[model samples]
Target chain A: MSGGKPLSRFHQPIEVPGRRLLHHIHLNFVKKKVVGGGGRSMNQEIPLIPFIDFLLCIVLFLLASFSASGELPIDKNVKLPNAMNAIEMMEAPIVAVTATQILVDGIPAGSTRAIIDSNTKQKIEELSEILKNKRELWKQLKPNEPFPGNVILQVDRKVPALVVKSVFQTAAFAGYPAVSFMVGRLAKE
Target chain B: MAGIDTGGGHGGKRSSNHEIPLIPFIDFLLCLVMFLLVTAVWSHMARIEADAKVPGPPREDEQDKIEPEKELHVHAKERKFQLVWKEGSTVVEESEVERVSVNVGDDVTFPELAKKIGKQWTDHGSHRAAADKKFDRAILHTDNNTEFGVVIAVLDAVYTPQREFLVGNKTEEVPAFHVTFAAK
Candidate 1:
């Protein structure tokens, strides 16, 4: 001990090879003892049980919400129409028609303004081409099952029906007969 | 008891007093939370499924020749919807359907239009309204300049009115009519 204070076991005094050394011992084996006002143990135990429980619950909920199809990519520009009687969303190649452009499978296919302005009863050339390619890819992936011809239309609520009609016709021309219009789900009364 | 030893008071300290490795557990949970938050789909997405008819050569056989079992055509315009019932090929003038057009004015929005359309279905369109109600299938033909919102609003209105029907063995509440979407 130095000046009535215990030294840590590691800081032992050195001695000659032939000489023996004597060290002071204290009842308190620890390096230091805190003289806290409260009669409490030296160790501070963090309240971790509640925190762990919360994290586990969060993990469980997120796992439950996770779906096999993964997350559906939503375009911020498209304000989807709300529907009360809509069914659960199906898996299909999404054809999103935004304010300015039309996208097939997240890739820009054509200009929305041009399609609306033309007002032609014909299928959209660009959209149809991309959809056809998607169809071919689908056919290759699932050779055994007949192609469902399912396609999802994610169109802005304000988009005129003319553009939607053109997209519909284009999807049909590209062998997509089953069209699913994606919409926000409204709570039932 | 089966956990990491914190090395507390090591003089004759027993391993049985070890505590759970909460720090490491917390780290693992944090990683999982981040992964799930990134991957989770928060919004509920719903689908309105319909068949898009492709223009093809007129059927040589009976599919086209035969009178459509139920011919209910809806002409969707910019501000009005003309709900028509057809017999054979002619658009019915007024034997069964009382009103054809439900117009949306400056004050009347699509929601109000939906309510009006739903009123029509619940009042006269469904077989529940009348035992001899004409159509069970309706065709929606949307025109240019009409907003897609209006089209979906009309669909929601049609789908709103439901009746419990015996299907196979179970009786379930289903939409009054099956709607097919078409563009003209």
Candidate 2:
């Protein structure tokens, strides 16, 4: 085996006294030499091109998917009343007011039955109790602040104007004065 | 050849040549995107719009100020109510409309008033009031002393379904033909 001198530049078998019985001892020696020399050759280095390609693909996929899944600009079921002087609020938190209930951040804030009952003008004490509870909750969330958040009220079109007014009054009594009504932009078509 | 021979024997022990596969990172971002897509909610806001006007007559140059739509003015005074229906420059109807009066200390529920109003409007042929030129609009104005509940009850009575009547003797129930708030 020693007389057969190494012919190829790619791989050469090695003979070590202690590891002669090892099945891949010769190939292991050649692999070590090829990988160790200067340590910067293309064959010896890790292939980062596929990894970079994979990363770029992942980045593009995430960007596309994130944009597609972002919060929706508008909902169609809410038929907002029109106002000649209403301005758009792009970043405000949403509060919905259907014909029968008030929803704060999609959770029911108060019942329409309660509001109507209070509007009967016989339940001022009950109305005051509800207002006080709302105030306490708001204070806990935002200590020393006058309001809970930028409230966007979405009242249904079919609700009476008086009912809407009473809701606003109740909200104001609850210490939320910076409330704004929500409205949709007219569709182009 | 001697350097290559010496280097080949020692290269296998280097840990710097190892690299981590990237399949796991791709999996993470995919999971994140899925989570965001599933949790997002999309809804819109609502607002109101109306016009306000003061009573006045238009001059010759302001002839176009006359809006074609009729305006009905109803005011609830002490123990009585007034209804003024206007169409253009002419007053189509003006009269003192009567309401059921309760004693000084009686608890009158809205449902009772609603029934009374419903019966009166039905008997007075309010269903056909829209077809007649005698009235354009019916305005209901109430005093501050008037209980808001009474107003809502009156409105509810006028708008709510009272009873169901069957058609063609089939015994199928349908809402009674009643007064609609749309008329006012």
Candidate 3:
């Protein structure tokens, strides 16, 4: 006991500022200290809360955006005709031709087939004139821009191909060049 | 010297480290959310809808009001082409013809049939004149089993440039020959 140094330095009690009181408690309770004579600090651990919050925000944003855009309702029973180059419908007029009816923007327009016989040539001419007038009116509505005007032809699988072609020709004659045939994507095999 | 030791000890013992500010990251994520929402809405706004139905002719009693020249019935059977004048219920003409080998069981080839009809129109103009002035329409009756492709082929043939005279003798060239699908 006589050879040992005085206990004053080893048992010294240090005073810290009041604002650092909680910090001191956390340091004592949470961090492990090395007890070797040579005392040095080690690198502290990084917090994970902010990183987690960031990822959550990203996920939530994606979910919110996807939910807002509604999917186009296509009839599963009808199989649409395929083409090598089919463009997506963007700002195009929708013309739905079901097995029993023809609808333009959900409104019933006319019968699927309109033919001109020698006797009804006058009627056919009248219809053609009306279509031409409508095309002119559309052009007037959106002047100075290349008519992004398109026709969406939704035909049933059972409808005759001739009927479909006739409709296509009629629309083409009416001055709409871009036509899109809508079809459902088949289930993966 | 005593104060210095105490200060060093406290500084070394501090557990909570300096952290990167998260406000910037939150702002970035919010911007991304807005961008995605705007894009989704734009796609929805760009969509369009259309319908595809073929029309058929009216019935006999219903046909009384319609002009006779407006209806022409074309009966396509195994190997015969029968042209019926609708208003008079009179068989204007019948022509026996060789059937195309193409899967045209009851479906007539429009091109071949149209050519034959064109020849008949020229040859029997007198008979057609005597039948009805409104004999402008041709009602095509096909078998249920006939392929739509064959019918289209027939229509293409009938409405071909060469067969345009079937519709009218007008100086202006008409691109389509008038014919309607007759209900069975």
Tell me, by DockQ, which candidate is best: 1
Against the true structure, candidate 2 has what lDDT?
A: 0.45
Ordered by DockQ, highest first, the candidates read: 1, 2, 3
Model 3 stretches astray by more than 4 angstroms = A1-78, A81-90, A112-137, A146-149, A184-189, B1-184
Interface RMSD of each: 2.9, 11.7, 10.1
Error of 1 at B88 (Å): 3.2
Stronger candidate by TM-score (2 vs 3): 2
- Predicted complexes: DockQ each: 0.47, 0.07, 0.07
List the candidates' TM-scores in order.
Answer: 0.68, 0.36, 0.35
User: By TM-score, highest first, what's the ranking?
Assistant: 1, 2, 3
Candidate 1 per-residue C-alpha lDDT over A75-157 given as tens digits, one digit per residue, 9 for 90 to 100: 88898888778888877899999979998767999999887677676677889889998889888999998898899999998
Give the least accurate 10-residue stretch of model 1 chain B, judged by summed lDDT: B99-108
The regions of model 2 sitting more than 4 angstroms off are: A1-96, A102-131, A140-150, A187-189, B1-16, B38-184
The TM-score of the first chain in every model comes to 0.67, 0.45, 0.50
Model 2 lDDT tens row, B13-96: 654333344556557756765665565444343332111122234556776554654544445466555545456668766666
Q: Second chain TM-score per prediction? A: 0.55, 0.33, 0.44
If both were scored by TM-score, which would come out higher, candidate 1 or candidate 3? Answer: 1
Q: Please report, as a residue range, the 10-residue window in candidate 2 chain B with the lowest summed lDDT.
A: B175-184
lDDT of 1 by residue, B1-184 (tens): 2366555756685545556667887999999999999888766899877676555546567374455453567666554566766655776532222223433331112454455555656544536533333336678877677778877776776676676666566666767777777654
The candidate that wins on lDDT is 1
Better of 1 and 2 by lDDT: 1
> Candidate 3, residues A28-63: lDDT per residue as tens digits?
434334322234555554555666576677757676
